[model samples]
Target: MTVLDDSTAPGLVGPPHSHGPRRDPAPLLPDPEPVRILGTPAAKTFDAELQRDLYRRLVLGRRFNQQATTLTRQGRLAVYPASTGQEACQITAAMVLREVDWLFPSYRDTLAVVARGVRPLDALTLMRGHAHSGYDPYEHRIAPLSTPLATQAPHAVGLAHAARLRAATDPAAAEDLVALALVGDGGTSEGDFHEALNFAGVLGAPVVFLVQNNGYAISVPLASQSAAPSLAHKAVGYGIAGRLVDGNDALAMHSVLSAAVEHARSGRGPVLVEAVTYRLDAHTNADDATRYRSAAEVDAWRARDPLTLLEGHLRAAGLLDDAGVAAAAKAAEVLAGEIRAQFDNPPDPDPDSLFTHVYARPTSQLREQAAELAARLDADADAALAAATDAEDEAR
Candidate 1:
């Protein structure tokens, strides 16, 4: 498939109806299907096709995460963190937007990145330790995945703020621009989180913070991260709208996210959605979760796997059959093989290339260091460069 380019969004064409009021506006149902979906809606509310697509995306994303984790164990990656319970939170939110919307993903939001049209193996490029991976974010309107937990939140706010400036610069250019940010529950502990919310709140920036509350930060549980009972409530302190959703239920996640994105795109300021999810795997490749958690707990959460639940829903909807499922599996397998090949076929960085991009102009310190290091080995610059390479390899 063609990776989306700059021309794909804003002016791109889709079903004309895509721009209209979304879904049904019927009064919300009662407690039996409580609105807190993953509470059920009092009644079925999504279009059949929309429901099916959500199902497919969730299935593909979950399987992708599972396979990537498996690959990590098989030595195909340097590290991997399974977004096992958070696929619904991502796919649902992404399904509602145009390519014009901006996505700021955390390291674990691999699914949303894929849903936004990033290639699968390309998604794994980061884990493969490539200098870069994934297509250009400017074309797709996706910011590079943020490794530091809460940093992306403010950056999303900044992007939305910039969008507003752009829209104001030309009245004819104003359009509905949405900014979506996905961060894990542990990220709430950082000051950047609070600052970002306050910035958006004050400016009424078109931004949304999708909090995948996966219940654990590495070995540290929620209790150790923050004293708040609900991460959504953090928005109240910032004077913004907050919604709590069941992250495990794909349908409910989509519904809530659709509403949130619409609100932001219409310039209604910001929204904070707390997706109550669980981490069914260790934090990353380096950690042994079994040491800090119980096997019983692990088994119990496995039973709540988002993939399995969504698969059951699809089968019930008569949308997924053996052939369809088989096709998706085959496609993912082929993509995985390609990813493995790319990782195996390595590229060597030029010894001098790093210095070329180190600055727009080489700083005095770097120039002196390069010159001194070059002279120490009797002008065989390769010797100094080789020594540096050895040091990096040793540190690793």
Candidate 2:
């Protein structure tokens, strides 16, 4: 039987239902204001121990940014995107996840990688132009710092879905491992970002997307990127919960991100959290932020620096003293020294090592190329040794 429209059957015609019923969009919308825990009543109830820990991490994260930027100027790092003002987001993103969980970070998120237990020097390997990923992803459960925008989102989704499938089949050793994918505000424009969120929403996979909306996507401001009210609102279209939080407030970031991570781990659909923050530094050491942004604007953000904000809160509460500050500084200095030492005397990367572990069975072309390179290197070494021997004979 064929259903007829009003032309064929008057009873078939529906009233005011051209596109069927519209879903309630209000439920999907983010809070009217970004969530704030600092300088609010909520701060009073926040755990003091957690606040102190966050303070230490924030201090260290800032130092990491500074050191990395300096390394770029000193010709150690190839490039550095200093997340100076966005330390709160980086710190909270790392601290919220468990060891069993995975973190997919962007190129600028070296601090997050370090916070997740990757050595500071190893985390900088990609930026140092030394390796694809300095440390193995499996070793730390963190993906390589993604240089391509939004690519890691899908990777996180796939990993989260895979983990859920394993947990479904194996109950004894099963654990709730959440995949936290971090992307910048600019990354949301990429197709991969939408695809990842769509997959997570459909599968109810254990994944959380923390988008740090650091004002500008390099030189292009967010206003020029999209007309969406906020980046968080984009999640509503994918049938997932959206959140907005003050990214600069460590406590707020921790609270919001922790909830999202827990929600994902509990097998709830994925959540999109847009942290409202600003990039204090240029896109990278090479890019001049002054061209796109104003000094006054940068000054305004610097006033609300993550470290300063947290430090003030801690001091007011008597949780941090002068001694505590000194201790944190000492720890940061030690880390800076380690990073400098590693860079100053970095181990020479074997060219042959690049050909190794690329595949289970090497391709014919790869084998040929590796052999060619090895032969060339051997010939060069032999030539150098012969020259040294001739020099010794001349000396005698």
Give the TM-score of each candidate: 0.80, 0.93
Which whole-number lDDT from 0 to 100 does residue 310 have in model 2? 94
lDDT values, one for every candidate: 0.77, 0.91
TM-score winner among the candidates?
A: 2
Please provide, for model 2 over 147-243, each residue's C-alpha lDDT reduced to its tens digit, 9 standing for 90 to 100.
8999999999999998888878987868789999999999999999999999998888889999999999999999998899899999999888899
Residue 217's lDDT in candidate 2:
93
Candidate 1 lDDT score relative to the true structure: 0.77
Clashes of each: 2, 0
